[model samples]
Target: MRNTFLKASFMAAMASIGAGEAGAADYRKNPFTLAYDGAITQNEPGKVNIHPVTYKLNGLDIAANVYIPANYDPKQAYPTVVVAHPNGGVKEQVAGLYAQRLAEQGYITITADAAYQGASAGQPRSTDKPAYRIEDIHGMADFISQYAGVDRKRLGLLGICGGGGYSLAAAQTDKRFKSVATISMFNSGRVRRNGYNDSQLNSVQQRLQQASEARAQEAAGAAVLYSGDANLSDEQIAKLPFELYRQGYEYYWKTHAHPNSTFKYTTSSLLDLMRFDATDQIALIGQPLLMIAGSEADSLYMTEDAFAKASGAHDKELFIIEGATHIETYWVPKYVDAAIGKLSAFYGKTL
Candidate 1:
C-alpha cells in the first residue's frame, strides 16, 4: 500500500509540473541542455567547450564538466570552484549554469551531479540522504585534485539553493575550501525542520508525522512519496504557500521543465534534512564567507540568520540583490552577474 502510494505520488509529482515537450521553454539555454539523452548512467558534457570527466566517488559513477582555465598548466596552479546543486536537482540543472558562467570568468569549475539525483549513482533513486549530500562535496574536492591544472591550495565553493547549505557544511568541516559563497541559498535543514522563519511552527510537527510514516514505508522496501508537487488548477495554484513557490513551478515546470528533470523529493529525506543543520556547524569554519541572496528571495532570511550565527568565520558578509527572487538569482544576468562579480572579488581577496 505504501509502495502504491509512492508510485501514485511520484507520477502525480511528475505530472504536477504539467510536463510535456510542447509545454514551453524550448530555448534550452542552460548548460545541462547539452546533455539530455536521458541516460541515467553517466554521460559526457556537450559544447560549452568543457572537458568532461567521469570518475568514481564512493562507488558512484560521478560525471563532471571540468573546465580548466586557458592559462592552466601542469606545473603552474590555478583556482578551482567546486559547484553543487539545489535539492531534488542534478548537476546538469541550474548548478551547471553557475559552473559554466564561473568557468568563463577564468576559474577552473567542476559541476558534478549529486548522488542518486541525476546521472550520478545511488540505489532507490531520488533519495536525499544528508550524509551523502555532505560527502558529495568532500568527494568533489578529492575528485578534482587529481587534475594537473588545479591549485589544491586555492580551492573554493559555489553552491546554489540547497547546495548553498551543503557548501557551508563542507566548508565548516573541511579547511580545503579557502573561500565559500552561495547564490539563492537555503538553510535546507533548518527550513525543512522548521519552515521559513519558523512561521509554519503551528503545523511543522504534524508534517513531521506525515514524513515519518512515509519513511517507515521506505524502510520496508517500499518506495516513498515525494513532497512539493506543482499540480493544481489556476485557482488552487494561486493558493500556494509562497509567491516564489508558485513561480518555482513556472520556472521548473512551465518555463524550464525538461522531460528529464523532476521536483520529487524523498519522503524520508525530510527527516535527514531536519537534522542536517549546516548553520549549527558554521562556527567551526575559518574561511572567509560570502553569502548572497535575492532581496525578495523568500529564502533570504536564512542567509541573514546564518551570518549572525557563524562565530569563527575569518571574514563574512551577506549581500541581498534588489528586486530579485530566489530563482531569478539562479539564472538572471542582473542577479547572477552581481553574484559572479562579487564572488570573484571575494575569492580574489581571500583565496
Candidate 2:
C-alpha cells in the first residue's frame, strides 16, 4: 500500500511538470516579463485580426504574430510588413501592438520572436546571438514572402528597438523588402562592446574577461546567470533611469498588460551582441528607409548616427517624434498613431 501511494504521487508530480513545459521553457531562460497596454488593439476584435503562428529558422522554432486587416479578402494579395521586435521583448509584446495597429491601417503585418529567444529555436536558449538575431529577420522575410495571401513583391519591413538594428542589417542584404523603418533602435554590437554611449568602452576588456568566466562556468556545467532584467523592486525603480526603459516598463508590464507575455529575456544574449555590427552594409540597402525616434530618446543617438552613415537613400528620412522617450513610443497613443500613419504612407508609396 505504501509503495502504491508513492508511485501514484510520483506520477501526479510528473503530470504537473509536463503541464508546465511551455511557461517553464521561457521562464527558465528568462524570468523577466514585458507589459503592454494593447487592450485597444487586442480586444477590439472587429477591424483587425491577429493570428499566432510559428516558423523554423536556424534550428529555432520562431514564434510570430500575423495581423490581417478587417477588410482583408482571401482572394486578394495584400502588401506586407515584416516586423522585428526590440531586444528582451517578444512578438506578443510591443511588436504585436505595433503590427496590429499597422494592420488596422490596412497593411498585412507580421512580427516575430528572435532566434534563440522567445518561441524561436536556439539551444542553450536565449544566448542573444547577434548573428542568429540577424538571421531571424532574414528568415522572417522568407517566412512572409511564402505566406499565403501576401504579395511577395509588395513587402516592407519595420524593426523596433534592437530589432531596428537587426532590420537595418537584414534590409541591406534582402531587397525583397522595398521599404524599411526603425524605431528607437540600437546598434547591439557596439552597445554590447562599448556600453551605452561608450561610457564603458574603457571596461571592454574587463567585461570580456567576465564573459569568459561566464563561458567557462557554463562549460563546467554551472547554471547560467543573467543580468539583463533587474527584476526591479519598488526601491530599485526609484534609482533607475527617469526616462526610456522604466517608463515603458510601467506601461507594458504594470498597467496595460498581456497575460500571456512579459519582459523576460535570455541571460547570456548580451555577450554575443558585442560582436554584432549592422552598419557594415548600409550602402547596400537601396530601398526607401524611414527611421522614427523621439528626439528626447536615449536611443535616438544611435538612430541619428546610423542615419548619418546610411549611404543608400536620397529616399531615406529620419523623423524625431518630438516629446517622447524610447519606451513611450513603444505603444503610446500619439506615437503609435503617428508611426502607423507614417509607415502606411511610406509602404503605400513604395510598395
lDDT of 2 by residue, 1-351 (tens): 323433553354244334444321222222222234442334244567777778777665677877888867767899899889887677766787788777877788888877656555555655677777788888888887877789988998899988999889989888888899998888888877887776788998887777777777787999775555445655676566545556755544444333333344444555676667768778788889999998788877899889988988669999888887888787668987887777778888998
- Cα deviation of 61 in candidate 2 (Å)? 1.8
Where does model 2 exceed 4 Å of error? Answer: 1-46, 256-271
CA RMSD, predictions in order: 5.0, 7.3
For model 1, residues 50-142, the per-residue Cα lDDT tens digits are: 666778888887766776554455587778899988876666556766776766667788888777665665666677777888888998899
User: Model 1: runs farther than 4 Å from truth?
Assistant: 1-48, 71-75, 233-235
- Count of backbone clashes for each model? 0, 14
TM-score of each: 0.85, 0.84
lDDT of 2 at 46: 55
Give Cα-based local distance difference scores for all models. Answer: 0.73, 0.72
